[model samples]
Target chain A: MITIRIPTPLRSMTGGKSEIEGKGASIGELIEQMNADHPGLKDRLCDEQGEIRRFINVYLNEEDIRFLTGKDTPVKDGDEVSIVPAIAGGAHD
Target chain B: MFIIPSDIWEDMIDHARGHAPRECCGMLAGTDNRVTRQYRITNILAKLNEAELARFDQPKLSDLKQLAPEERADIAFQMDARELSQAQKDIRQRGIELQAFYHSHTMSPARPSATDITLAMEFEHCRAALNLPQPLHVIVSLEDRDHPVMRAYRIEASRATEVPVRRQ
Candidate 1:
């Protein structure tokens, strides 16, 4: 089982559960399993073309998936996945 | 007057353009309206190789790209301090504050991306630590040459608001 950590902005989709467990041997399967349990989240995280949203970032055990093996990257049991939304605030000159 | 000089704008444009294909990170410093300092904070390209991009998981990518909130704050603070130190040393120097931070989006729009927003929120704490009256966050879109736009925002009352700047 892989652990998925949801960000605060998307918590409503997960029933307010920050972390979830999924059964998958790879990252892609894990996301599929998560979508099966929590519908509507896949749309938010992936584009219509099935690509990960450019703005949203996914991390597996502190390593960025983009720099690793992408969605096909294999995941071992007990791996932790975190979803972080990019939000902006503050002043500029 | 928060007016950006044309030369500085040119420099910023060049810097943003140079870091295309991935993303560029940098700092902006100035007193009042005249910018006197700029520094590159990070280059995401350095962290990613061609092999990693082909086979990484989204979660792993997110985690690797994740700049810790505190670490970001520290970078801003350190940049601010360096600017302050230089300001103090310049007898003719005007009291320049670390006015804003500048970063670029290679394939994204000039408007703040989700990551930009998150980083801006983190930067607010750094600005507060320096007692800055205003903290500015700037995002540069390098996707188009003719339509490049820079957006500025401020965190006030725990919310982000647009702050207007006269384009040079």
Candidate 2:
């Protein structure tokens, strides 16, 4: 089982569970299984094209998936995944 | 509401003045809704990705890519993640929590703009990952240059609620 860490904003949908365990062999599979258990989770994690949102960063064991193999990044049992959103703004005025 | 000592309050104003024309950003740390310390962070506003930039002004990605960090600092602000982590650690060591994140709005009002509100919402979304409280977003508007207006608010989702600030 791989552990997925959910961010705060999306926590309201997961009943405030900070972390959850799911079964998957890759990052994509992990998100798929986790979303099956927690509906709407997939929408927040991915777009209509099934691509990770640009603002969201996912790291596997401290390595950014984007720099790795992306969704195809392999995930083994006991691996930890974290989802982080970019906090930015102030372009007005 | 936030209680800011007179000297500290002045410092914030001065900071805004020092960075006039450009936005300055920092985090305030304190307890009981009172600010005790302020951490000035380097604003990397123009360094943000294209997707985030598109929501604000229509600065072509090509144009932004051509300018340097110093040039970009004039219109946007971004806090370095490493510096933020260090500040958070120092604040925790001082036994104080991060109370608010403040930024200067050189050309806007003392209220959060649509972009600011979106960022504040993102801040709330990312707070748990940082183990910090939902910060009161503070804006220092320097539209007049001579007179500045500072206001605080709790921005959630798309709504903002003003939090009165008292000068102690």
Candidate 3:
């Protein structure tokens, strides 16, 4: 089981659980496991194309998964995965 | 109701002023509804390259890819992801939660504009989906350079209800 830390914004879906255990060989599968336990969690973190949303950042063991293989980044028991939403907006039309 | 002390209040104003035509943004963090600190986030508009811009699915942001880099910041702000992640961590470590997300409206009123409302609703959806408290959306209108106005709102169900704001 991989240790996944949920951000405050995304915790509601996790039943307010900050840390959740997921079983997967990669970040992609981990998300599947998590979404199974907490439905709709994937929509907020990923887009329709299954790519990580631009507004959300995922880190694998303190290193951004983007620096790794993104959703395919390998994970193992005891690995740490975290989600952080990008705080962004504006007054644009 | 949101009560902002004079110091943080002034800092927000100063941050908006300092950025001028370019909007400034930040987060308000606090414990027990009492705001304690503000984290200013850099707008990474100017740093966004074509490839990155194309990835923004938000209509308002995607629409900006046509505009010149200098002109884009005038109407929009996209926070630096690294800064945003760090701010959230720091606030958590400080034993407080991020209570509000704020940004300057360089040419509009200190109210949630259409774009702001739309985005706020998306966040509201996430908040509601998990039954979490929805954070406030604070806007500082710098339309009148000298007398900037700040306001806060609770965006729910696609509607924005103005919340009382006070400077302590």
Candidate 4:
């Protein structure tokens, strides 16, 4: 199980809880399993291509997973995952 | 509606003025719909790295790379990602909510443009991510230069409705 820190914006979807625990072997699986438990979460975080939307930042512990392996980044029990909104410019995504 | 203290309101204007043609972006943290603390973040408008882009994903981004760095910031603004993430953690630690996101419109009106509207709507899709019925985006327009105008907006579902910004 991994500990995921939910941002305030996504809190309503999580029943207003700021943090929750879920299961997954990698960051990708974790989002799927967590979405199974939370519902609609994976959709908010992942796009149709199964890629983490560029406007959404996912951090594994203190480092943004983008700088690492992105959604493919492996995860294990007790790891911390934090999701926050990223604002971008130019035409919409 | 968003209530901003006088000092913070002035600071936002000053931040916009200081940046001039370049857009200035930051976050506002507070309780309820009133602002208490303002964070001035470094705008990485023209500092995007290749990792952040995927194959000329957005035409504007690709076009942005064509402009001279100084002229680049004028077309758009994006806050430094690491700084924003760190700021969120700090804001949470202080027990205050991040009430709104703010930026300057150096050449346009205080109202959101199509791209700004799209940006806000993209943010809106977070599903009440801010725990507010609509996410608030405050824009300061330096179009007049001599008289900077600021306005508040509630952006959702591709719509941007003007909300009063009171300087208390």
* Strongest candidate by lDDT: 3
- In order, candidate lDDTs are 0.56, 0.76, 0.78, 0.75
- Give candidate 3 regions above 4 Å deviation: A1-24, A28-55, A59-85, B50-63, B127-133
State the weakest 10-residue window (summed lDDT) of model 2 chain A: A84-93
Lowest-sum lDDT 10-residue window in model 4 chain B: B48-57
Question: Which numbered prediction scores highest in DockQ against the true structure?
Answer: 3
lDDT of 3 by residue, B5-35 (tens): 8999999999999998988988898865568
lDDT of 1 by residue, A1-92 (tens): 78788766566888987678888888888888888989977877776677666545566775557667878889998888876533222112
**Candidate 1, TM-score vs. the true structure?**
0.46
Candidate 4: residue B37 Cα off by (Å):
0.5
- Lowest-scoring 10 consecutive residues by lDDT in candidate 3 chain A? A84-93
Model 2: docking quality category = acceptable
- Sorted by lDDT, highest first, which candidate order results? 3, 2, 4, 1
Q: Candidates' TM-scores?
A: 0.46, 0.67, 0.70, 0.67
Q: Report candidate 2's interface RMSD in Å.
A: 5.3
Per-residue alpha-carbon lDDT of candidate 4 for residues B40-144, written as tens digits (9 for 90 to 100): 988776554443433122566576777776676786777766667667777777998778888888888887766677556555554343343344788998989
Off by over 4 Å in 2: A6-86, A91-93, B48-71
For model 1 the local lDDT of residue B146 reads 68
**When only chain A is evaluated, what TM-score does every model earn?**
0.90, 0.92, 0.91, 0.87
